[model samples]
Target: MSVTREKILELGENLIRTKGYNAFSYQDISSELGIKNAAVHYYFPSKENLGTSIVKTNIQRFEEMVDNMHSRKFDEWQQLDSFIKIYVKSYREQKKCLVGSLSPDYSTLSDTTKQELKRMIDIILKWLTELLDSGRAKNMFNYNDDPTSKALTIFSSLVASLQLSGIVEKVDYKSFCQSILDDLKP
Candidate 1:
């Protein structure tokens, strides 16, 4: 990506995390970057376009993380713990996951952006589904429900937990997630 586009994505991601999707504007990004509104427009013609780009970038990063987790020489449960650890560490540093920050504002987002968000959610869900399926096959997990649905439930809970952590003051996300992991123990 061009430096300008990367800068815009970074600013937009931060602004969206701090202020929410509907709360920030193109002017907000331009002002923060000390650039003109027209210049911001030159990169992203519309707010929806910028929003879609942000979601796409976040999804790409998430996929990369999942890939890294898979490549690690760990057992399935260990990999899941590693994934949760990555989230907790990122939340400790960034205050919110980029995709989790967008969840609440999804209703007001454009169709394209909403679809992008759904795709990101699906990616996480799919990862969980495969893990659960593999674990069940190996007698590592005892769940009987469809893996996809169960995965969605776990994924949704994690996202909600992260968002709740972001809303609280001086919260220990690692502890919160550890409790979640404890509950999901199998």
Candidate 2:
């Protein structure tokens, strides 16, 4: 991404996390970035456009991380563990996941942003489903729900943990994530 685009994305992500989708404006990003509103417009012509771009960028990054995990020689359970570890480490360092932070305000976002967010969720669910299926194949997972639904549950759990960590006790986020992963073990 261009430097300008990166700046916009960084600012927008922070704004969306600290505020909410409707609480932020292009002017907020432009003013924070020391740029013209037209410059922000050049990158993302509308608030919906900017939010869609943000969600798409974050989703692609997450999918890439999952792809990296898949390329490893680890078993499905190990791969899922590694994926959760990545999120925990990221939260420990950055205090939030870009997508995780945006999720709470999802219901109030534009249709375009909402669709983009759903796409991200689908990508995560797809990865989890594949991993869960592999684990079931190896008799390592014994969930009563279908793989897809179980994957969604796991995804929801992870996101909820991150949110709770941010609000309750930031220092306990890693431990909380570890406990969640431990509970996932068969």
Model 1 residue 133 CA deviation (Å) reads 1.7
TM match of model 1 to true structure: 0.86
Runs of candidate 1 with Cα error greater than 4 angstroms are: 142-146, 167-170, 184-186
Which tens-of-lDDT digit does each residue in 31-94 have in candidate 2? Answer: 8888999999998888888889888888888877776766876778777777788677767665
Clashing pairs in 1: none
Error of 2 at 135 (Å): 1.4
RMSD of 1: 2.3
Local distance difference test scores for all models: 0.80, 0.78
TM of each candidate vs. truth: 0.86, 0.83
Q: lDDT by residue for model 1 over 64-173, one digit each (tens)? A: 87778768756678867877876777676765666778888878899999999889877878888898888778877667588888787767767777677756788777
How far does residue 73 in candidate 1 sit from its true spot (Å)? 3.9
How many steric overlaps does candidate 2 have?
A: 0
